[model samples]
Target: MRTFAVLNQKGGVGKTTTAINLAHAMALRGHLVTAIDMDPQNHLTAGLGQETHPQVGIDEVLLAESDLQTTVIDARQNLQLVPAGTRLSEVEQGARGVKGGLLLANEIKKLERQDFVFIDCPPSSGILSMNAILAANEIIVPVSSDYLALHGMSRLMGILNHVEKRLHHKMTVWVALTRFHGRRRLANEVRDKLVNYFPGSVLKTPIREAVALAESPSYGQTIFEYQKRGNGSNDYSALADDLLHGRTR
Candidate 1:
């Protein structure tokens, strides 16, 4: 199974949004998908239309009190979830020492059922993010089309480089430009910059700015379920195709 961490240290850059939609897209393709909500805020959990699992969540699993299979919730047809709870913040604080970084990875070894796993990381370089990195073999970075986003990229690049050296594994990364306005000069400029910097790793289909994407989560639905005909749906579907065939190779 391919484990992809949808991460960005910069907040409000559509990290959870991408993970929610992309995981659904993967499931639509008949892949057994599991989304791990590593963010303490549990945005991905709520975004996927789930409340905190009353019995167990990622916190319990990370603490070694529960296993991934026992905590996972069936979110959709082929999509499952390891939801996050309020205690995740406390768990993040306690994730210290050598064992902390590998906590999620150790739990993940027991999950032999999934075909694709998408981990939603918090927008900070902390223990939660560290766990995401340790558990993932691939990463999907969703960045808005702006200069500040590039600044975020620089920091993320450094973090990934450091993690790769530590783990001794080269992770496959792909960049997805979100909130793109095709007619805007600055948006086009940012896209060009990303293309030049990332080369073949930047996805061809950019997620256009759409009200539906923002509205979907409030309704506890993916764009496909909330607005089937919108640009968001088409773009995210295209992105999944890109990952499965185009850029991942």
Candidate 2:
């Protein structure tokens, strides 16, 4: 499986949103996709229309209390989900030592028949986030069009560098510009800076700021299900195509 961790150190940067929609988008294309909610908040679980407080979830897998396969639940036709159970917050305190960080990575290696696995990481750079980073072969950083988001991106880059050195494992990183506004000068400026700094790592399709993108989560639906013809749906579809075709560096 081509595993990806949808990660961002800063909250409200479309990390969960991108994970939910992007996974579904790939599943829509007939690929078997599994989305793991590594965030304790359970946003990805709820957003996928699944019960927020599942008894068995990624937390159990990380804690070694349950196997990953047993916790898997169907979310969509081709999309499967591993919810972030209510006790997920305890993982940081419960699972200590170096072994804690490698739990998710070990569990992921045992997975079978999944074409894509997207892990939705927590906003903070905690043990949970570390597990996601270590498990995935690729990292998708969602950069919203704002100065604060740009600052967050810089912080995340530093964390990534540190992890790569400490763990001696390198991951392919891609930047997805989210909530972009073509009409706004600030948004355009942010895009320019990202393209300049990231070069080919920045994804070509920018997810435009759209009502459908924001509203879909509330209704427990992906953009395609909520508004298929909307900009949100179109952008995410293009994004799936981009990743599938190796359009990014």
Candidate 3:
């Protein structure tokens, strides 16, 4: 399985949006995808059109109170989810040692099913995000076009580097430019800088700043089913294809 964690310490940069849409788009392409909602908010779960059932979430697995098999809930066709819940906050506060950070990774290794696993990480550098890094084989960073968003890349890279050195994991990193507008000069400049800095690791397709992406979650749907004709749908689908086929390579 191509396990990836869609993460960014900075919130509101479309991390959850990318995770929800990308997973949906990948499933649309006939791949069996399992999206793990590691965030306490359960946005990915709700975005996939599944209600956040109480007492059923990553908290159960992380607390070692539930079996991995019993935790998975089916979403749309070809997509499954290990949903998140309100209890995640309690799980975070309770789980304290090195074992806590490895909880998600251990559960993931035991899964005999799944072609792709996308982990939707919380917007903080907490134990949950650490677990996502430890569990994933690669990291997909979704960044906006603003200059302030540019400042966050170094901090994110620093965390990954620490994980690589201390944990002895060799996970790859891919930086994706999101909410890009071609008509804006600043957006173009940011894209150029990102590609220059990231080199071959940057994805070719950029997600346009589309209102459809922002509105889809409200309707409990992905862009594919929400507004199929919009640029948001098209770009995300292309990104899903590239990610599935290893276009970054």
Candidate 4:
């Protein structure tokens, strides 16, 4: 199984949106996928249409209060969810000052086989984010088509560098442009600049800025189930295809 962390220190950059849709889209492609929300908000749980709180979640698993086997809930037929609780902050603080802070790496190994595991990291460089960085084999950064968003990408790269040195895990990193506006010249410039900046790290599939993507979450559905022909659906499909064949290209 391959593990990826959808992370960005900046908020409103479509990090949660990508994690939710990509997890569902991969499951649609007949892959066993699990999404773990490291964020305390528990947005990933709600995005998957789950309202009832699970008895055990990532917080308990990370704290060694629960095992990984019992922490997972079958979100769908092929998609599973390791739900996050509002008490994640307490769980993180509880692990403070411990050696080998990569608790997530140990928990993830218990799941014998799965196609992919996506982690939705919190928008900070706290202990929770450190565990995600240490656990992930790959990191995908979602940046908006704005100049200010570029700064977040650079900051995250620095953090990833630290993860590699301290955690001793070399990560395969990719940068994806999210909420892109095709008509704007500045957006086009930003996209081009990002490609120039990262070179091979840039994914060609850019998620267009679409209202359907924004509206679908309220009904607890992905873009595919919401409006199949919409831009949001098309872009996410492209993203899934790119993700599946990423190792090849």
Query: In lDDT terms, which candidate is top?
Result: 2
* lDDT per residue as tens, model 3, 100-138: 888888999987768889999999988898889999998
Q: What's the TM for model 4?
A: 0.95
User: What would you estimate as the lDDT of candidate 4?
Assistant: 0.84
Residue-level lDDT for 12 in candidate 3: 76
Q: Candidate order by lDDT, highest to lowest?
A: 2, 1, 3, 4
lDDT of 1 by residue, 85-150 (tens): 667887778889657988988888788878999999998888988888888988899989899999
Clashing pairs in 1: none
Q: Tell how far residue 240 is off in model 1, in angstroms.
A: 0.4
lDDT of 2 by residue, 183-211 (tens): 99999999899888888888888999998
Return the lDDT, model 3, position 180. 91
Angstrom error of the Cα, residue 29, model 2: value is 0.8
Better of 1 and 2 by lDDT: 2
Flag regions of model 2 displaced more than 4 Å. Answer: 52-54
Looking at model 2, residue 42 earns an lDDT score of 83
Question: How accurate locally is residue 204 in candidate 1, as Cα lDDT from 0 to 100?
Answer: 81
- Candidate 2: give the clashing pairs: none
Give lDDT for model 2.
0.89
Distance from true location, Cα of 138 in model 4, Å: 0.5
What CA RMSD would candidate 2 show?
1.4
CA lDDT of every candidate: 0.88, 0.89, 0.85, 0.84
